[model samples]
Target: MSDEVVENDLIHCIYCNAGTVRFSEADMVSLLEKAREANSALGVTGMLLYEEGSFFQVLEGPAESVDALYEKIFRDKRHRRITKIIRESIEARNFSEWTMGYAGVTRQDLKEIEGLNDFFYTKKCFTELDPGRAKKLLEAFKDGNWRASLR
Candidate 1:
């Protein structure tokens, strides 16, 4: 695959995984702050959703920058069993406004997040979700449906 990142091409990569080590609330906040700063400088836009030690993320931007960030994530020693849900070039971004929008979904919100009921209800034990389904789930959160519908 070409690692070249043409300025005009926008690429998005979505993935999910369970954490190898638990992150405290403070740890999550600090991590998000660092990620937003780094991703902003790199022109990356995405959303990160964490629930019950599992993470679902969608990162979109120049190919080179997204690839570099994924490389670091793969080696972070925190994420385990990473499985990519989708990777493709797109004309636009779903999260163009946020460097890294994030939400830490709680148990009460799980049942109302549309596609994530099983994930949290079942204790985050499962294989990869279908690509389209995964995309919908990400979009739902990115579009503020998760918060509105859940609350």
Candidate 2:
């Protein structure tokens, strides 16, 4: 078989969830480290944003790998009420530069972003956000339009 990835071979998924509890800085660091290692091994690339106790993530890779990873995340006790916002085939990776790029967002940062609803700042999860809004948020992050500290 040819070792090549075509448009149909790739999928991108976006999801959001709330943390079971507030995570300390060290806890976040540890999470990022483990995620980076796991995603790199799976040939996945994505971005993760944490605001308060909520998480918004974008994962892109082979369909099988992405689906498997999403299943693992869905079952993890660290998260609650996981909601998938988008899943679709893509021609190229949106976050190809990072195994898992991350940002610790703040209320002020949310306020600075236009088009996001007021609810985004008060809620601990993004389950209510539509796919269009979620995609806009991801695009803003990808474009470095937000002031959140990213890594």
Candidate 3:
């Protein structure tokens, strides 16, 4: 048998019930580290999004390895409320470089998202949502856009 490895592009979304854990800077570091290990071990590459104290991580890699990694993640004590979004085969990785990336969404930001209709909010979840809606909603906020509001 040879040591050569086969690879494919598969996107995996691992959900986390972040409500149980307190969000902190230390937790951020640990989360990224685990993501890095998972990516390296499974030959996966993708990005992570944490919002409203929830985790939405996307990983792309070999079918078998990615599945195995997913199982491990589900079993990990640090991770709970695991929900595998979709693990279908894809032609390429959406976020082919980052081990993990973090974004902070404030209470006001949550309010903005909530104000959006179901159709618009769902699109923002996985699909490419129209920036117009985001702009409009942000404009409605007293603080303005995310950048300005977050500041």
Candidate topping lDDT: 2
**Model 2 residue 22 lDDT?**
83
lDDT of 1: 0.77
TM-score: which is higher, 2 or 3? 2
Q: Rank the candidate models, highest TM-score first.
A: 2, 1, 3
Q: Which 10 consecutive residues of model 3 have the lowest summed lDDT? A: 142-151
30-129 per-residue lDDT for model 2 (tens digits): 9999999999999999998887788889999999999999999999888888899999998888788789989887767766667775766665446577
> Can you give the TM-score per candidate against the true fold?
0.82, 0.87, 0.60
Q: Give candidate 3's TM-score.
A: 0.60
Write the residue-wise lDDT of candidate 1 on 16-124 in tens digits.
Answer: 8855567898998899889999999999998887776788788999988998898899788887898887888987777777788887776667556677677657665
**Residue 59 Cα positional deviation in candidate 1, in Å, after optimal superposition:** 0.5
- Preferred candidate (lDDT higher): 1 or 3: 1
Candidate 1 vs. true structure, TM-score: 0.82
Model 2 TM-score, all chains together: 0.87
RMSD values for the candidates in order, in angstroms, are 5.6, 3.5, 9.1
Weakest lDDT window of 10 consecutive positions for candidate 2 = 141-150
